[model samples]
Target chain A: MATTNDYLKGTKSVLPILTGLFPFGLIYGVSAVTSGIPKVQAIAMSFVVFAGAAQISIVNSFSSGISIITAVAIAGLINLRMAMYGASIADSIRSDRLLTRIFSSFLLTDQVYAVSITEKGKNMNTNIFKFYIGAALPIWLTWQAATIIGVFAGKTLPSWLSLEFAVPLTFLALLGPFLVKSHFAVSALTAGIVMVLTRNVPYNAGFFIAVLSGITAGFLIKNRKGDR
Target chain B: MNTSHLWAVIILSGIATFIIRFFFIQIKQAPLSGKVKELFSFIPPAVLSALVFGSVFENGLSSLTPRNPYLWASILAGITAVTSKNVLLTISTGMIFIWGWNYLY
Candidate 1:
């Protein structure tokens, strides 16, 4: 069972991450509306889809020449790693009831998973499921509120805001942490260059190519270092 | 796509994503080797870089020019992210620079 302290700790731990999400959510809301996604659905997608990167990219896939199947594939591919997080934390919740697992799985996300996994290392026998919930619920609420606000605030904002830069900047912030790791750095560089070169590929196949090449480069580099 | 079609896309894709999240958690046997599991770890960085690079350099060589404050904003953002390691700090730095650049020039 999760005590009040654990839940509070989870909430307090997530405060910094919450501040970061506000802009991303606002940007997603603003962008999704203009990307041919209906305003209402855009708000709905926040809580429904709940994955920011996948949600933004899926909305991008809606452009002409990209098939619906392709859109669906993009969503699946982007989120495949969620299962990895699911598996990583599975040991902690092995004995929980099905309903508990289902609810927990619904809220599983990168930030929540990161906090829960890090906490796991510090304390044994912690109720991670409750911690996960405490962390996830606030994120969910913040995202939805921001997205809704963005949807309504769409187009009314000043033209000088350059809202277009918000997403990339946010992503850059996320990618920045991995730069110190040689293998990860090389992987990011490989993907970045590949993406730029393949930008014009039909149906945005560049995304798949870039990601694959990055992972391959990172894996190979890591393997070589291990062998030597 | 019509509203209905878009709705279908949203609901279907949402379901597919949820299934992926639920698969390993719901099942008892979500086994993997050390090597394969490590590969999964590379996914986020790779994906984040792809998205960021593709967006920042969206216009190919055109975006590399000095007028593109996004490029500059990204540099500041990258530095803030690594040094501060605070997501909010990095975002604020980037947002402030890009927005400020827009008005100043």
Candidate 2:
């Protein structure tokens, strides 16, 4: 059972990540609106798909002459790792209720994973379901509101704002605290270099490739240390 | 191509994604093995770095040249991220730098 304090703490902890998503949400809305799709259909994606990277992938797919099946496939592949996230954190929740698990799964996201997983490690007794909801609801609402604003004011926003940079900056901030260990540094550097080298690969296959190789590289090195 | 196709894509992808999210939570298998769990620990950093570098260099390595305001802002943002370790500060500072630099240059 989650206390009111747990919910408030979760909300407070996620505010920074929500700040980072604000600009990216605006960009998604603007890009989807102008990406040759009808505006209402584009905005509806925020409600249905609710994954920023997948939404961007689908929009790019549409613009590139791909079939809808192909677009869905690409987006699904980009999100395949969410399965890993769900599996990794499955142990944290104490609830056995089917509805609770289903509801919590719906809110599973990169930011929620980052905050909840880290918080889970620090203290084991907290009600993760409530914490997840607190974090997820605010970010979900922000994304919807920002998309609407982006769709309407897409033309009014200045390119000089460099809003696109926020996405990368957000990733960096999430990564910084984890870099103290050489294993983590090795993984991040390998992933980054691989992503750059394979940027030209079509359908963003490079992303999956980089993810696999980078994780393998770090996993191998960490195991090597364990062998000694 | 058509409106139906677009809707199909949205609905299918959403269902596929939710299924993935739901898979492990529903399965009542033995807990993940130790080695597998160790590998999972590396994923967050690996995935986050791949995403950051992918966006920063989306236009290819040539775009990282000093002429690109984003490159400079990224460098400064990286420093702030490491030093401050604060999300809101890192993003706000990076954008402010990019906006100021773009205006002046």
Candidate 3:
């Protein structure tokens, strides 16, 4: 498998994406502290939860009156997207040791999923497990490290950076090339519209609904074209 | 919440998230069939669109207009991505656009 080479390649491919990530880590760290969350929990969540979006959202929504179950439910629902990522990459990384698959799955995130899928699309002959490990490790380290720094720094950051915008922008960059494909574009558009329509849906089930709508639209469109 | 309570939330949330990420991988088989694989390909666009649009409209539809720097910045960012096809450029453009917009008013 040339595990080392494949791993390094995975690392190299995802480094550029981290530019946007570093700021997010900082924001999460600073925001957690600013929100008057205990420093221990702030650090602990970053270390254990390891899911950036979920961690930040959970922290943002937290109040002394909020119950543990409600907090966990929020985290779980926000992270429900991971299930799809896990299922998608399962076949590719299934050849690895069970331990490796388990650990790599824990490290999965939007950036890692995006990177892994792009690598898969190129039909790279690389070892998928090693590549996934490579892709995931850097993000894990960068997030933990940046978060600690931000938490300790504890200074209110200037709002002008708009680093949060970088999140959607990064997704746009990753999603750009694919938009050229008609089916993908239609699917994306359909999903975006549904997302807007479902903004007020309870419990953020809107994500699930939009995803289902987009996938169905794309699949149907592709099949309809095939029958021609 | 107290420290113990916070810890409970953190640890339990972590465990729950890990299980979600691990569930499918733990049970998966290799060499997926064509139909399943094809369905998989649509996931990114759908998920990304859902996510991107989620953030884009984070302030709700009333904020969909240009006055919402996030909205306009994202639009310009989309253009940059489509034309430049460069992640760094696209991100820089988007963030910079928002910063500038916010700075002015």
Candidate 4:
């Protein structure tokens, strides 16, 4: 049983990342409303889905009159990485309680996973689940609040300020830090090429292609290097 | 506006997401080789880049020509992202560039 201090310590480590994500959440709220979701539904989705890419995909698909099944499939595919994040963090939690593991896994997101992994290297004995919850809960609440604000404001918000730009920029900021390795660069380039080539693929299947291509390139490159 | 349809989407999407997340939980005990770990590491950057590029470019499936300055502004923003590594700076720069482009042209 970790004390409040332990939880605060874990939560503090993630504050900076959450700060970076705030604007993106705000923008998502605005976009979700503009994309034709009712203000209440838009805000609710932020809390329910709690994944930016999937929320956007679901909203976009619904607004465009795509079938519900297709929307779910696309959103599911985009967020498939969360499962990997959960797997990576599972080793850090020594808990035998199924409820604890399930709750912690539910909060798993890219930022939480990254921050947890980075922090785990420094504090090996820390309660990773507590830390993960402390960090992610704030982000989740903020996302819901921001989406509500955006929904209420709707198109009344200025286009010039453009919160939509925040989403890509956040990714860019996050991606820049990970580009130190040449293998990463090769993988990204390969993915980009494949995405462009398959841009016309229906139902946004290009995203999966891009992911597969990048993973394949990265795997092959790493294997070749190991062989050498 | 259709509540039933919306709920269906929500439930289906939620279930799909849960299944994907559960896959990783189920495999947590397995040791990932170095190559597999490296491959997983690449997923974020690759998927992100594809999404960013898709958002920036219009008629991306059809034309490579710079028919719109919004696209140019995004390119500049991408460069800013790579160099500055500041999310606020890149977004503001792109927003201003596109607004100015829209105003001028």
Candidate 4, B1-105: lDDT as tens digits: 265687778777777776666566656484666656555667777766666665555356554667766567767876777788887777778777867776776
How would the docking of model 1 be graded?
Answer: medium
What is the per-residue lDDT of model 2 for residues A1-228, given as tens digits with 9 covering 90 to 100? Answer: 444577777798899888878877886787666656677877888888888877876766666555776678767766766777788778765358999888778778889988988888886767776777888889899999988888887655666665545556766777787677778778888988888899888866777688778788888887789752
Better of 1 and 2 by lDDT: 1
- iRMSD, model 4, in Å: 3.3
**Prediction 3 global C-alpha lDDT:** 0.77
- How would you encode candidate 3's per-residue C-alpha lDDT over A29-78 as one tens digit per residue? 87677666777788889978898767865664464235677668756766
Q: Write the per-residue lDDT of candidate 4 for residues A93-195, one digit (tens) a residue.
A: 5357777666666677877788778878887667776777777787776677767776777779766555555555555555665556677767777776777
User: In candidate 1, what are the lDDT values of residues A129-208, reduced to their tens digit?
Assistant: 67778898998889999999888886676657766566677677777888888999999899989988888887778888
Q: How well is candidate 2 docked (DockQ)?
A: 0.51
Q: For model 2, what is the error of residue A84's alpha carbon versus the real structure, in angstroms, after optimal superposition?
A: 5.0
Q: Mind listing the fnat for each candidate?
A: 0.66, 0.70, 0.73, 0.47
CA error at residue A187 for candidate 4, angstroms: 2.8
Question: Which digits, one per residue and each the tens of the lDDT, describe model 2 over residues B10-83?
Answer: 89888988897888877765366877767767777777787778767867677778787767777788788788
Stretches of model 1 off by over 4 angstroms after superposition:
A1-9, A34-36, A62-65, B1-5, B61-63
Q: Every model's Cα RMSD, please?
A: 2.9, 4.6, 5.3, 3.4
User: How does chain B score by TM in each prediction?
Assistant: 0.87, 0.74, 0.70, 0.70
Identify the candidate with maximal TM-score.
1
